[model samples]
Target chain A: MTSPSVPAAPTLTPALGRKLHPWPVRIMHWTNAMAMIVLIGSGWGIYDDSVIFHFIYFPQWARIGSWAAESLLWHFAAMWVLAINGFVYLTYGVFTGRLRERMLPIRISDVIHTVQDTLRFKIAHEDLTVYNAVQKLLYIVVIFAGISQVITGIAVWKPIQFSGLAEVLGGFQGARLLHFLGMAVITGFLIVHVALSLLVPSTLWAMLAGGPRLKTPKLEAAE
Target chain B: MRSPNRPATPPDAAILDNHRAEIRMLERRGILRGTLSLGSLAMLTGCDISDDTSIGKALRAMSSFNDFVQAKIFDPNHLAPEYPASMVLKPPRFNAYYEIEKIRPIDGPNWTLAVSGLVNDKQAWTREKIATLPQREMIIRHICVEGWDYIGQWSGVPLRTFLEAVGADLNAKYVSFQTADDYPSSIDMATALHPQTLLATKYAGETLADPFGYPLRLRTSTKLGFKNPKWITAIEVSNTYMPGYWEKLGFNWQSGI
Candidate 1:
């Protein structure tokens, strides 16, 4: 009962110091978030220059670069930061095994249960250190989306140079649409993540400073 | 489905307020993040940081870095995709910085391609003299920075051959074009020498349309559409950077495809 993180994560709890995000994790998370914001806003600006869809339009307010050229500059500049930071995060997460420990072994049953409970306004977030199946799925999906954005972005940006990648994405126009889709998914994730953090303020506090040092979760072993 | 360790309560207003206060009291790191995110939010509502002098400078610097990278990555021998002659568009889309009415059609009979700058032979070229040079044709995608694309067939002397014939300094950093329409543009030396680079005289086997550079235009498959200035007036082989018409207006100078 002393190992109190999830359905069971005995091997990870103490090693991870689950109450606090590691310094590298915290640093990379904030930096990645900032760069993502810049990328999304600038991307909107560039898309507006010659929109792929006639019906879809983003107002000037929703854009970063005032002009198409300036938007491209901002987009490229932020891309390097996002890419380098993402690479570091991936290396750290994989090498340290944090990605596996925190977000692996998702069961479909658990996901269904979580969804049913969420619809009924029942959340099992008593432990900030543990992620439900839904949470794990979301984190993994967002990471994949981020990687896909980079790939598709390169395809459109240099369709001739990266012809194979463009072909993979169904050519130049296809690459642009896929990149936009990635942005939409990430935006959706951002909304849900922020909302959840508000619902569980302690989790936000924990992210900022390690949570209350629980000597034990009233050990289930005590009967 | 509450766990045995559950708090048995939802977060209250007091908790939210306390965390808000704590966030406000955090050190410079938190404040900096707050300001940045706030600025991002402000940007979403029409804040124009692009107009800021410092930010403009930073964006310009980034564009220059992109140019540097594009130059480094450009493989001289890598040809842009060539289309079949059948794929070439008839009456290709005409595009220029100005309206159709503003097209300054070159007076072909009076036209002479004045060559200057770093060149061994400064002799100007006439349409009749250029006609005598070996002619080659290519069908390549004309990709515009505004996101449209067209495939067109252009016939002309390969720019490399013409440069050699004119004794232009091939080693020069740039070959700038001043067009009859006053739309000046320049390309990198590597692109200038690319096999697809042409001093185009005809489009789709017909002499150029008045609106599409009647006498001669510079066409390079390696660069964006705007870099291919129409209605050529002068050619300068130079070591110095010559500001292009669009580049002066914030478009990246090295607009390599």
Candidate 2:
């Protein structure tokens, strides 16, 4: 056999010729993130103000008084922004098939590979793809959660106008409970996502700057 | 487990190519969903944008601001249009809670208006005392925030007339209404004393039903259905205002009809 081919040297460089994120995707991503943060924060305010949960005793210093009406107004207004933005983004994703490519797993293998890569920390910084497996799963989950919130919100908004939907959800009380639960889930996920971002600084930078510097590994030259 | 600190291998050209292909597909799907949803939201926006739609404007204006966002959709100054006597309907199903379990007569002798707290005088008066006062009648539509509406004729003394006699104390901020059924609610004294508000004793020209505040009820035409507390009982005047039953349970307190 001919002498073994020499291995190419590893290099550290800015991701050259790599496509930057599309404007719509970038804009929507940041907007959704910011809106969700505001919504979850204001939602906590509302929960604190709720009379039903006011039975719990807290020190005067630790306790926050209920401002139900004010909290409701905050929630309602922010809801329109969050809802409209999500509707636009989701619609765009579906029609453009971007949702299927970026947000949805292409196949079982891709999903499996993603999971394995995440578990093994085998994801490459230089990967041209925008999201890794964990990110993809989270994006999908958030979209579904947003849809659930809209459905449950309407059920509570006009119980009579959407009587059938309300009935399906077991009336106003049930709808209210579901809406509360949805908020809690979203809030929980947000906390986890922030934590992960801190753990993976590069991933956070990718979202912020639309790309990151990646170090390519050395490879053996073919004989 | 592989250490994340270790550099990850770059995905091969084939994988990148596959991702590019998938991204293209997703892009197309995303565009379709975006257009469809945008169109739907546009339609929704259009419905609420017209300036002449009082309720829609109120909802939208209030949506953006911290204020109550009242457009004065219903004018309290104007008397609620009277309905023909024949248009009045009786309770097909009596809607009383406490009296449903037990029948109780609310007569002039048994009924007393407890005018106290934040008032110049704290005293109880017989229903006869109320009946002897100047009476006014109006046919008004009771609109529930839940969206049902019904027209009923009310005959009673005006709450403002009573407040005038008692001389409301300067510190009085709200009037808390407690009915015989134990159903309770509160309203700003200003709202309680509004011209359309009546301490009603008659409906459809007949004596009140036990289920319908037999001797008297606080009938405020300017408010949603629940604000018009039924049944005659104690009235406490207070210096601070708070939410009522449904209001505490997520319903609007002012609950303008």
| Model 1 lDDT tens row, A78-175 | 89899999999999887766787668768999999999999999998886666899999999999999999989888767777666677789776788
The C-alpha RMSD in Å for every predicted model, in order, reads 12.1, 20.7
Q: What digit string (tens of lDDT, one per residue) describes model 2 on residues A79-143?
A: 77788889999887766555654554345677788788867977554454556666777767777
Clashing pairs in 1: A61-B44
Q: Output the worst ten-in-a-row residue range by lDDT, candidate 1 chain A.
A: A214-223
State the DockQ, from 0 to 1, for candidate 2. 0.04
User: How do the predictions measure up, each by TM-score?
Assistant: 0.84, 0.46
Candidate 2 C-alpha lDDT tens digits along B1-257: 98888668855768767689788978876565456232222222221133333323443455534224322333445444455867776651344324466756566565677777777767786777777889888786665443335678888889888777777763477888877766688876656766778988888777787767778788887665678777758777788765566554444555543
TM-score of 2: 0.46
Whose TM-score is greatest here?
Answer: 1
Poorly placed runs, candidate 1 (over 4 Å): A1-14, A210-223, B1-52
